[model samples]
Target: MKEKVLILNIGRCAWGRCIFCGYSRENYPEPNLLRMKVDLDRKLVGFEGDTLKIFGSGSFLDDKQFPREFRRYLVEKCKKKGIKHLTIESRPEFITEDTLLDFDGIDLTVAIGLEVADNDILKKLGKGMTVEDYTRAADIIHSKGFKVRTYLLVNPPFVDDIKESLDRSVSFALQHSDSIVLINLLPHANAPLFDLWVEGKWKPLTREKFFEITRPYANNPKIELDVETFRFVPRFPPEKRANLEGVSSEILNHPHFRVWQEYLCDWYEKPKDKTIALFLPCSAKKPYSKSKTHTLIYKTIKTLPIFKNIHRLVISTPGVVPFEFNDFYPFNAYEWDERLETPEIKKEYIKVTKKRIFDYLKHHKYDHYFCFFKYSAESYIALQEACNELGVSCTNCLSRETYEALKEEKGNPLFKEEALKELREVLSKVKQKGT
Candidate 1:
């Protein structure tokens, strides 16, 4: 049966600081709610559809954004229109118990922003809510027997590794929501993310990378994923798109692309016999090896050659990426946390850091594990907790002088200045070598 859908514009978003959203593009031109009663009644006079998608340009349930009478009228109009079901655009916070009751008779499918599962990305995007918050909202939604529909943000900012970011996004959404909606971020003149884009900080994922990430989920016996997810929001139209052809196949098979297992490898070429390990926090620098903090750490470590086994690995959110392989693929070209301070995000940092740290220790026996991170504990708090849990003690080796010197020479090394420069450069080189 063909599903007839009705999209009704109900005002500007009440909470509209989402970094990717454009004020004029996503929400605006306040509709005269004075005529809302007569207008909606006329619009739905003889309307017949399976679904009624209401857009307030904001949260449909937020009374401040959409008046209570308008919301109640929506349900009344849908019922009068003979609509069997209704779907509405709302942020996570608006999906409350009382909100659900407002549309009790209709089969309600609440579309909430499960934007991205990673809290770090959420922080960068100005998405106020946390993953824990989303989980609670999702549970509340499901517990009430209301259908759950999630809107996932594609090509969200703060990561140079676009492909990895997409894969993580899809995987997270599939496990959480019933129907997955991939909303591709289209940058506009006044978009919050545009400022970051021009500064060479935030880059949208290309069409080529998007296809690569979607390929694996094609035949999965899970929930249906939607491409036309941005019904009310702006999309990356054809003319504005990057060329989506000729991505390297070797990249598809590379270990870096397969992050889950690549991160869990039991053995590498690094000498493990009585080795001295330098555990460092992630940097804003593209490759941690090139970062001033890392450079200083190397200089300090090299002074003592007698400490033979010098193994360096970065403590990053994408698991433990080896220091030597830092310049390879994603690690070399990607970006991560700049000033992460949320306690909510901190809990997540500990979970991933614990797994990668333990995996590193389990495979190799280091004579001494020296954590030289002089940054805030938020950066390496996971590593500390992980080491303690594993009955392993990591020494804090870097002195205050080294820490101060590292900060003095820091710069925005990861910023690419143009869209997809690092991704294209890395891909072109890798493709030429036939890897």
Candidate 2:
């Protein structure tokens, strides 16, 4: 059975201040109701799908975006087109008993953005609506004999454990929603979250992380993994953002996972033909650039000819961060120190780091892998184990004598003359090879 789905974008959303959303930036002062009707009519012409998803960038039920007369008009239009079911988006605040009452005869599924179940996390996201609001809307939707679909972000910002928080959120949303839509948070320009990303206060989940988080719910029929964040990429000026689109696109195209998958690949996929990769250890400071050790490393490395050609990556707590993203989110923000944590914590860190290394290796292609780390560091062990497992050899930029000397020290070993000399020699070889 080919489940035909037609998704139409209408008016711009209201209450656009959700820290993670970029829609509000596009929702300028305009006569949305008039524009929405024109957009709707154009899309609905000769409509041929079992399910029609009407997205107004906000609440489709809101009169400001879609007026009462337009609601009646849409109902007639859908009925005439023999549209079997209509899925429309709304904010919890805009969904009321009276609002649902307006579309009385239609088979409707009302979708609401309940990004996370935790109220504190919701507040941090600047979602504006509370759990109570969503539940209240869901109750009204149910009372009106409509289906409730809820949206959840896997590993949302400000969350501690990606898997745990997603588990809790999915569990909670399932109880209230007839269906659930899951998407990884995607950072976009103009959103408040983008600013956080720039400042190293937040980061969006990678495709691998998203898959891992949503895998538990894949078998559940009620759960819909919104792979659309990866597709139908909204265009933005090149100067603003190169490829990434808004988070709202994920919400709008939840069922079109293929489209989303392609889009995500375009945004996050690494260039596979790179000739050299330098895997540096994570820093204690937020944004490795701010750390004294990393600062010295960069300063020393930049003097080498190969530095201009090699891909710079950080072996960090969150995962492998391309040096360009060192200033973004968890890469820049996390303060986890294995030295002060419990054994279990340390074990988990090693496991996660190793898994990330494997994931990175699986996706990225590099002719040479050079690592600069304290010989005894957990990151080094993890990367070494991954390389060994994959039959890939990685050269260490620290000599055996230098590693033995500082194997027990707390100071920055990379700053030492021996370490610097080894780094220079190894990079010199790379430069020579490139020539």
Candidate 3:
């Protein structure tokens, strides 16, 4: 049987934050009953397939996207038009019995984006829903006498073991889904996974890998392989992220910035030693080592006896970056100044930074945590909040009194004598713990 897919617009997704979603770049018109009906008529003019798969920019069951009246209208229209099977996509959260009602005469299957099985990996992709969420939704759909189609993403980003993740995801999907659609994760310039791919942290799955991973499901009638997606997985280097002319506030507000922040903290493996972690603010200069302020801070930090075991990290615009990754693509590529950002962007920065810092500290244990930044900096606020939540003390190199004293200074506050004095005093108190 021939299959026809219709890509419709539904204004925006309820959760449009998936790192691998290319639809984030799309701007859809607000869903109106009359307008959507007209658009659907135009798209259905030449429909000839026995199976019709309707894909909206987001969930088809979302009332904001498809009103109840329009939804009933569409189902009746499809039945009238002699369409035998209808497939529609929706996020698991929207798969309630009320939403799935009124389509008794038609054969309907609700497709859900159940990308992965592991909750940790799902969080890294910013999927916004967990495996359990998908399971619950799937059970509801099945109980309502409707079929569930699971969209499985192969070789998603931030996964250390590709085969294991895919294997787990496929196994989990099989148990919960009546049908499985295998999609090779495609790279989009506007998506977060693209940055990870560009930075060499992730790569596209090879044809060999795809075949090997999907071998067990080859004979299953329910598994539908999406061969076309693999064709669009760009293998060439992405030119958009590099060689940009100058730093602008727009770059910091982009979606990739948030993804970069989440992945940076998620992927980092802390050092084995129970060493002191010294968090410093990023500089406009690339690699941070090239910045004059960072150079002076490094010089001063080296003088401390505990410095021998201290691990230096930058609380950068892209979130935390270890000193060793200073030369990495995003770490070295972008420049940011909190002053240039709008109030909204700055507030988001603080929220994202705080969560990331908390998550990083939660996983990566350190004997001691200390931070040296301008007392009034955004990173300082986030670090303080994160440390407080963890019940761990993070010594601030620049004391509040010193920040008050130097806030109005002509030069950078970091270089002032009082700030350095505070740094020395704080370091002196943190005795070097045995490695």
Top candidate by lDDT: 3
Model 3, which residues run further than 4 Å from truth? 46-49, 230-240, 244-435
TM for candidate 1 is 0.49
Looking at candidate 3, what is the lDDT of residue 170? 86
Please identify model 1 stretches exceeding 4 Å from their true place: 1-10, 23-32, 220-435
* CA shift of 128, model 1, Å: 1.0
For candidate 3, write residues 1-435 as lDDT tens digits: 778788886778988999988685567778788988887788888777677889877898888878888888888878877887889999989888888887776788999998888899889889999988999999988888889999988778877787788788888898988899987776775677777765668866545567777777778998987744623523223455544323354464444455454444444355665388989988878878989877888777788777777888788666777787677666687767555677777787788778778877876788888888876788899888989999999887787777877988799889877787777778777876542
Give the alpha carbon lDDT tens digit for every residue of 285-384 in model 2: 7678888877877777788766766777888555677776676543444555455666655566567667667767776768788988887777888899
Preferred candidate (TM-score higher): 1 or 2: 2
CA-RMSD of model 2: 12.2
Model 2 spans > 4 angstroms off: 1-12, 32-35, 228-267, 270-362, 366-435
lDDT of each: 0.60, 0.72, 0.77
- Which candidate number maximizes TM-score? 2
Quote each prediction's TM-score. Answer: 0.49, 0.57, 0.54
What is the Cα-based TM-score of model 3? Answer: 0.54
* Selected candidate, larger lDDT, 1 vs 3: 3
- lDDT score of model 2? 0.72
